[model samples]
Target: MYTKELFHSWVPKVLQKIFLFVLAIPLLVGSSIYTANMGDMYSGLGTYAETLTFANYSSTIGMMVGLGVILKIKPRFKSKNIIVFAFISLGLLTLAIGSTQRIDIIVVCSVIMGFIKVFGMIELVVPIMFIVSPKGDRGEFYVVFYPLILGASQLVGFLTANLAYNLNWNAVYLMSAIILFGCALLCIALMHNKWTAKRMPIKGLDWFSIVSFTAACLLLNYILVFAKQQGWFYASMNLRLALAAFIICAALFIYRQRTAAIPFFSLAIFTKRRVLTAIVLFSLMGMFTATSSLQSALTSILQYDARTNATINLAMIPGIILGGFICAMWFKREGSTRSLLFIAFSCFLLNTICLYFLISPVVDIRYFILPTFAKGLGMALVYISGGFYFASSLKPTELMGAYPVVIGIRSFIGTAFFSAVFSWGLYQFQSDSMMELANGMDTMDAWVQARGGGMQLYASVRTQSTLIAVKELFGYTALAGILVLVYILLHPFHHLHRRQLIIRRKRLKGESIDGLRAESFDGKDITATAASVST
Candidate 1:
C-alpha cells in the first residue's frame, strides 16, 4: 500500500467533506452538458441534428456500460487516484470534442468520456452519501442528492447557454475542460491517495456483454434517430441494416447474460413484479419527459435564441427543489411509493395539459413557466421514487447487478427510444399539417398577396403547422399520462404489508426496534443494506 499525504492535518474534516461535495458537482454536470446545450452545438458544430442525438446516445450508453463494471474496477485503484485520472481524461475528451468537426470522432470521444466520467461520479457519490447521512440514513442523503443533481444540471445548462450565446458553442466545451482540469488539481490537493477497499484483481467481468449491449444500443439509437431522415425502415437500406444489426447484437447480449458464469446483469432480477412495474413506469416517465424536446420547436417557431430558451428552462429549478423536498419528506414519513408515483404522474399530466394549450406561434415565454415547473417537479419525483421502488424490490446480492439496467432504462434506452419516436411522430404530424394547411391556402392566397405574398403565406403555413403538430403531440401525451395516473391509483397497496413483514422479521432477529423502523421505511436503506451484504 502507498501512503501519500495531501491535505494538511489542520484542514477540518467538515471542510474536507465540503470539498468532496463540490468536486461531485462538476463530475455530474460534465456528463450531460453537451446534450443540454444541443441547439448551440447544432448551430456551432454545423452537424446534422441526428449527430447530436447520436453523441448523446453514445455517451449515455458508455455510462451504462461503465456502471455495469464499476464494482469490479473499483478495487483495482485508490479512489482519489482513479478520480483524478477520470478528471484528466474527461478534460482531454472535452477539448477533443471542442476541437473536432468530425461526427464520428465526437461520438467516439463522448463514449470514452462517459465511461471515464462514471468512475469519478461513483468515487464521489459513495463518499458524499456518507457525509450527507453519517448514520447511513438514505432519506436524508436523497433529499440532498436529487436536488443537487437535478438543480445543478439545470443551472449548468443555463450558464453554458449563456457562455455559448456570448462566446460561441466551442466556448462551452473549453469551459468544461478547464473546469474538469481544475477539479483534477483540486482533488490532488485536497485528498490523500488511499485505497478504500482491498486491492482485488479485475476478473470475471463479462466484456462480451458490455460490447454487445453497447453495439445493440447504438444500432437501435441510429435507427430511431435517423428513421425520419432516412424515410423510415423500409425506405432506407441503412435503416434496414441497422435494425438487423441491432437485433443480432441484442440477441447476443441476452444470450451471454443468460449463459455467462458471471453475467454483467443477472437475469433473475426481472422476475420481481415490483422491478417490472418500475421498468414500465420508468419508460412512461421517459416518454413524458421526452416531450421537453418539443419545447425547442416552440422556441424556434417563436424565434427565441439559445439564451432565451435556456432562461425559460431555468424556471424548472425551483420546482425541482420543491419536488426533492417533498420526496424526502414523503420517504421520511414512509409514504406509499404508489402514492408518490401517482403524484409524479399527476404532475406530468398537468404539465402536458398546460403545454397542450400553451404551444402556439404567438406565445409569451411567461406562459411556459408553469408547465416547465411541473415538468421539473414530475422529473424529480419520478427519478427519486422510481429508483427507490426499483431498489427496494431486490435483495442486496442482486442490486449491483441490476443497478446498471435500472439506470440504462431510466436515463438512456427509454429516453432515447421515446425521443426518436416522438421525433418521427412530430415530423409526420408537421408534414401532414402543412399539406392540409396548404390545401386550404388558396382562399388565403389573395389575402396573403395583400400582406406579404407567397413567402409570407409559406411562413405562416409552416408556423401554424408546427404549432398544430406540437399541440397534437401534447394532447396525445396528456391522454397517456391520464391512463398511467389511473393505473397508479388502481394499483394495490402492498408495500405496507411488506414493510410490516420486514419489521417483524427484524424483531424476530432481535435487532433494535429503532434501527428496524429506519431500515424498513426507505428503499435506499434497503439498498445500503444490500450493498453491505454484497461487500
Candidate 2:
C-alpha cells in the first residue's frame, strides 16, 4: 500500500484527476461484465469437460501471461502507451467474442482478450496514479478509489445481469463492448504510467505453474458447474479431465513454488506462522460460509427443486446486507475487532449448527432462513475483524501486499478449489450411502425414496436430495471451520499487531493531530482507526 509521501505534493493536478476519473470507470466494469456473463460463459463454452477445460485454460493462461507481459515489458510508472494499447485490445477482444457460441473461435478470441483484461487490471491503475498526485494522500487516495473500482464491478453486475437476460446475449455483449470502448477512451485521456520509473522487481515466468493452475481452475469450474448435469463421473469424461487437472495443478504448483527463483507463489510467505495460520483460518472459515456454492448446497438440500437451480440459491443476500448494515452501525459505535470477529465466527459456527443439527426434514422454509441470514451477517463481521488480524500480525510492507493477495487468491482460486472439494466429498459420501442403502433393494422406487427422492422421474424429489446432500456439505464445511479456528488461535501475528499498537500509541500521543497517523497494510486501517476513535 502507499504512504503519504507517495501522494503528490498538493492537490492532484486538476487535469490529471479528471482524466483519472474517466479512466477509472470502465476498468471497474470490465470484470463485472465478465461476472454478469459468467454463468452464460460456462454454459456457452462447450459440452464436454475438455472443451470447458481448454476454454478456462486459455483464459487463465492468457490472463497470467498477459499480466506477465505487462509487468515485464511495461512494469513501471512511465508512459502507458503500451497499456492503452493493451486496454483497447482487451476491451475489443472481450467485446468481440461476447455472444460467440463457436467453441474453437471463442477459445482463440478469449486468449487474445485475456491480454486485454490483464492489461487493464495491471495498467488501469497506472492512469489513476496521476490523480493521486498528492503524495500525502497516496494511501488515502487508494482507499477512495480501490472500492470505486470494486463497487463499480458489483454495480455493473447488478445492472447488466437482467439486461443480458432480457436483450438476449447478442445486445448484452454489444453493450459490453460499448462500455469497454468508452473506458478505453477514458484511459487514453486519464491513464498514465506513474510507477513506470520506480519499478517493482519483476518475477520470471512459471509456465508450468501457470498452465497447471489455469488448467486446474478451469477443470474445477467445469466440474463444479456441470458436474450434476454430467452426473459427476458416474457418467462422463469430464471427471477424468477434472481429476487430471487437479492432480496436474496440485503437483506442479507445489513443485514450481518450491524450486523457482521467484515462484508465482511463495510458501515462504507462510513462514510467518501467523500469516499461514490466518490464511488457513480464513480459508477454512471461507469453505462453509455463504459462498455461492454453499447457497447452492442449501437449495439442493432444502427440496427447492425447480428447472432453475441457481435461482433458488439467493438466500444469502439478506444475510450479507444485514452484515453490511450491522458493520456500518457497529463501526460507528463500538469498533471492536475482537467483538466483531467473535460475533462473526460465532455466528458462522452457529449458522453451521443451524445447518448441521437444527435443520429438520419436513421443516418449513423458515427453518432455513436463520442460517443464511446469520451467514451474511457473519461475512461482514469477518471483513471488519479481518483488518485486526492483519494489523496485529504482519509487518507494514507485509501488510501492504500480503492480505490483498490473500484476498485475491481466495476469491479467484482458493474459494473455487474448496468448493470442488466440498462437493466432491458430499457426492462421494452421499452416493456411497445411497448405494449402500440401495444394495438391499435394487428397485428404482425403493432406491430413489431411500436416497430421499421421489420414485417419479419428474417429481420434485426426483431432483432433490436436499436434506441428505446438504447435511454432508454442512458437515464438511463445519470441519473446515474447525480447522480455521485452530489455525487462527495458534498463529502469531504479533509483528503486525505491534505495528498497529505503535500507530495507535502515536495517534493517542497526538501524531495524527493534523493528518492520519495510520499507515496502510494496503489501507486496511484506512477508515478503521477513525471509526475506532469515533466509537
Candidate 3:
C-alpha cells in the first residue's frame, strides 16, 4: 500500500533501492531455511503433525499480527532499524533451534522466532513500498522476486538437506543460523532508515478480536494437524484442549469482529464476487496442488533422497521464470484478466493431468519433469494474474486490508491447514489399504504369496499401501483442478454477456453504434461477448 507521499523525507535513489533490496532478502532467507530443514526437524522430533504444526502455526499467527501492526503502529525508530533488530533476533533463535534437543524448548524458540520473522518481513518490505519510486519497474521486480525466492529455496533446501544427511540435522540449522547472521550483518551495514512513518497512536484497537483470533488460529491449527494421529475424541489430553480452545476462541473471534468498532475482518470484502473467487481459487491451489505434498511423495514413497529430489525439482524453476515473464508481458500487452485466468487454469489442469499419469511407486525421476514444470508455470500465472486482479479490485487505500487477509488466509492458513488435511487423508488411506490387503490374504499360501515369501512382508505391504494412498491423493487433486478450471471458465461469462446485452439494448433504442464506446476492464475486449452468460 503506497502512502499519499513517501512516509518520511526521500533519500538518494541508489541508496534507497539498495536498502530495500538488502532489507528484503532476510525474510525470504529465513523462510526458505526453515522449510528446507523441516524434514530434519521432523525426524528429530519424531512426529510429522506435531513438528509441522509447531513450526508453522506460530509463524502464521505472527504474520497475521505483523500485518495488523504495520497498519496500526508507527514505530519511533526507522523501519530498517526495526528490521535489523528482528534479523538479529531471528539469527539467534535459529541458532537456538539448532542447538536445542528438547522439543519443548524448540517450540518456545520457534514462537519467539516467529514473532521476529513477522516483524522482519513487514519491516523488510516497508522501504520498498514507501520509499521506492512507484514509476520504477515495480511489476518486473515482483515478477522476478517470487520465482527467485521459490527456486532459491529449493536449491538451499537441497543443500541443507545434504548437510543433514552427511553430518546431522543440527548441522543443517547451524548453517542456516550462520547464513542469517551474515544477512543480519549486511542489514546492519547497508540498511539505513532515512524514511519513517509518523508515529500514530493506535485508536479503537479491538484487543479482544486480536486475542481471540490468535487463540483460534493456534488452537485450530493444533487440532487440525494432530486430530488424525492423536485420534478424534478420546486419545490425548492435548487434543481435548485443542478442540475446546479452538471452538471457544473461534466463536469469540467471530463475535468480537462483528461487534468491534473497527472490525478486524471486514465481512464486506467477501461481498465482492471477484475477490472472494480469487481467494477460493488461490486457497484451493495452495492446498490440493501443494508442492510440499509432491516433495513428500517423492521422498517418503519413491525413496528419493532430498538431493536427488531437489535436482528433479529444478525443472520447475525454468517454468516459473518463463511463466512470470509471460504473465507480465501479457498484462502489459493484451491485459486480459479473463484470458490470464484461463491460462492459469489451463496450466493447472495440464499439471494435474500430467501428475495423474506420472505418479507411481516405481516411477523414474525423469517422469517428474513435465508435471513439476507445468505446476511452476501454473503457479506463476496464478499469482501474477490473480494478484493483479485482486489488487486492482480494491481501492488503493484498501491494500493494507487485502494484504493480510489474502496472504494470511490463502498462503499461511491455506497451505498449513490443507497440508494437514492431506497428511491425515494419506494416513487413513494407507491404513485402509493395508487392512484390505491383509484381509484378502485369507489362506496361508495366499498370505505367503502376497507377502513375497515372508521377507519383510509388512514393510512391503506398508510401502505399497503408501503408494496407493499417494495415487488416490493425486486423483483427488486432479478432480479439484477440473473444478477450478470450470469455475474460472464460467466466471467471466456473466460480465461478457451482460455487456453484450447492454449493447443490444442501445441498438434497439436506435443509439448510434459507431459513437458508442466503453472502457475495457483490463486492456483487452471480451472475446466471449457473443456467448450467453447463462450458458
Candidate 4:
C-alpha cells in the first residue's frame, strides 16, 4: 500500500531492523525445504526415477545459471529491493511447482525455482552486509550471520515438510508464497534509498565464459545424477551427451579464463596452498552433510513417516546453534582455527561411527538423536570456522573471484557426487546381500515361501535388503571418516607439534629461526624447518 520513497523516509529504525530480519528468513529456507524433502516430492510426482533425475538435474543447472548471473551483475540495485523482487519471484515459482500434477511441468517449475532461489540467496546477504554496521564489538555480527541463516533454514525445512504432509503438500508452497509476498511489502516499507555502494559496471561481464561454465556444470551434474540409470558410459544417450558436452564446454571455459581480460573466475589465487586446503575442506563438508542416504534409511527401513522425520531434523538445530555459539566465542577469544577444525572433524568422526553402529531396521528414532545432534554440531563448527579460515586466507580483492567457484564446487558438485556414490553403494550392497541370502536359504523353507509368496514375502525381502544396504552405507561412511580424521590430525595438528619440538630444540642452541617464517594454511606464520617442508 505504501510507496517505496514515502515509506522509507518515515519508517522507524527499530521497525526497519525487524523488517530486515524478516526479509532474511525466507530466502534460504525454501531451497533447504526442497532439498530436505525431495523424497516426498519424488512420491508426489509418482516415484519415477527418470522424473526425479531430470527434476533434480534441471534444478541444479538452473542454480548454476542463476549463480552465473549473480556473479556477473555484481551489486547494482538496492540490496533490499533485489530481495523484494527475488522473494516475489520465488513465491510465483513455488506456487507453479506446487500446482502441477504432471512431472514434466513440476520439473520445469523446479528449474525456474532453483534459478530464482539462488538469486534470492545471493541477494539476501548483500543487504545485511551493506546495512548492518559491524563496528567494534559488532564485527562478529557478520561472522555469525551465515550460520544463523543455516540454522533457520534447517528448522524451517523440517517444519515445511511436516506441514506439507499434514495438510495438502501444495498448501505449504502457497503459504510460503504468501509469507514471502508479505515480507516483500515490508521491505518496501522499511528499507531506505540512501544506502548505496559502488557497483561494478555490467559491461565487464564475460558472457561466453558464463555460458561455457554453466554448460559444463549442467552436463556434469546430469551425468552424476543419471549415470547409473543410463548404464554409465556406453549405453545411454544421456551419458554420451553429458560426456561430450562436458568435455567441450570445460575446455572452452578453461581457455576463456586463461585468455580473457576479464575472466569470470580468477584461478590464480588458488595457487596458494591455504586456498586449496580450504577447497578440500569445503568439499568434505558437503560430502559429510549429504544426509539423503541416512534419511532414506530411516524412511525405507525404519518406516518413519514425514512428521517423525521432520521432528528428527528439528532436533538437529539446537546442536547446530550451540556449535555456532561455541565457535563464535572461541574466535573472539583468539582460539586457534586449526584446533577448532580438529575438534569439528573429531565430532564428525564420532557421529559417523555412532551411526554406523546404531542403524538397523528395528532401531528406534530415539537412538538417532545423539548422533544426529553430533552431526549438526560438527557441521556448524566446520562451516563457521571454515568460512573464517577461507576469508582470512585471501586478500579483499581475491574474495570476490575465489568464493563463487569454491562454493559452486562445495555446494553443488560435492553433494551431487557423494549422493551418486551413496546411491550406487546402496544398490550394490542390496543386490549382493540379496544374492547371499538367496544362496543360503533352506531348500524346504524356500519352497514353502515361494509357494506362499505374496506381498509379505516381497515386503520382507525389501526391508531386509534395505536394512543391509543402509548398514553398509553407514560402515563405509565411518571408514571414510577415519581417513578424514587421519588427514586432519596429520596435516593440521600432529605435524605442528613435531615442528614446534624441533624449533624448541634448535632454539636451545641459539639457532636462527628468524628466516623460517612461512605462510601457513591457518593464516599464521609457521617456522618452516627442513623437516616441515619435507613432510
Q: What is the TM-score of each candidate against the true structure?
A: 0.91, 0.63, 0.84, 0.85
Clashes of 3: 0
Across 94-207, the per-residue lDDT of candidate 4 in tens digits comes to 777777777767767766777777656655454455454334222254346756776887777777777778775677778888887887777666665543445555667787
Residues forming the 10-long window of minimal summed lDDT in candidate 2? 526-535
- Which stretches of model 2 miss by more than 4 angstroms? 1-22, 32-70, 76-83, 104-115, 124-154, 189-267, 289-291, 297-340, 350-377, 380-408, 425-464, 475-483, 486-491, 495-535
lDDT of each: 0.80, 0.54, 0.66, 0.68
Task: List candidate 4 stretches off by more than 4 Å.
Answer: 1-7, 47-81, 102-124, 127-133, 136-139, 193-195, 198-201, 442-458, 492-502, 506-535
Return whichever of 1 and 2 wins on lDDT. Answer: 1
Better of 3 and 4 by lDDT: 4
Query: Model 3: per-residue lDDT, tens digit, 1-535?
Result: 2232222334566765675665566566554225555666678767564656555666666677656545555454456566677777877877877777666666667666765676666555544543432443334445666666666666766677677778887887677677677777766665454644565455656788878877787776677666767775587888897788889988887777677778776667778776787787688777645646755764567777766766766777888888878866875675667677777767777776676676566778787788778777877777766775665555544555556678766666677667777887788899999998888653357757765665567777888887788777877877877777777767762255566667788889988767656556664432211111100
Worst 10 residues of 4 by lDDT: 526-535
Q: lDDT tens string, model 2, 247-305?
A: 87768777887887866555666776546645654665556543445555555445553
lDDT of 1 by residue, 9-51 (tens): 5678778778887788998877533555677787767767888
| TM-score of candidate 2 against the unseen true structure | 0.63
Candidates sorted on TM-score, descending: 1, 4, 3, 2
**Could you tally the backbone clashes for each prediction?**
1, 24, 0, 0
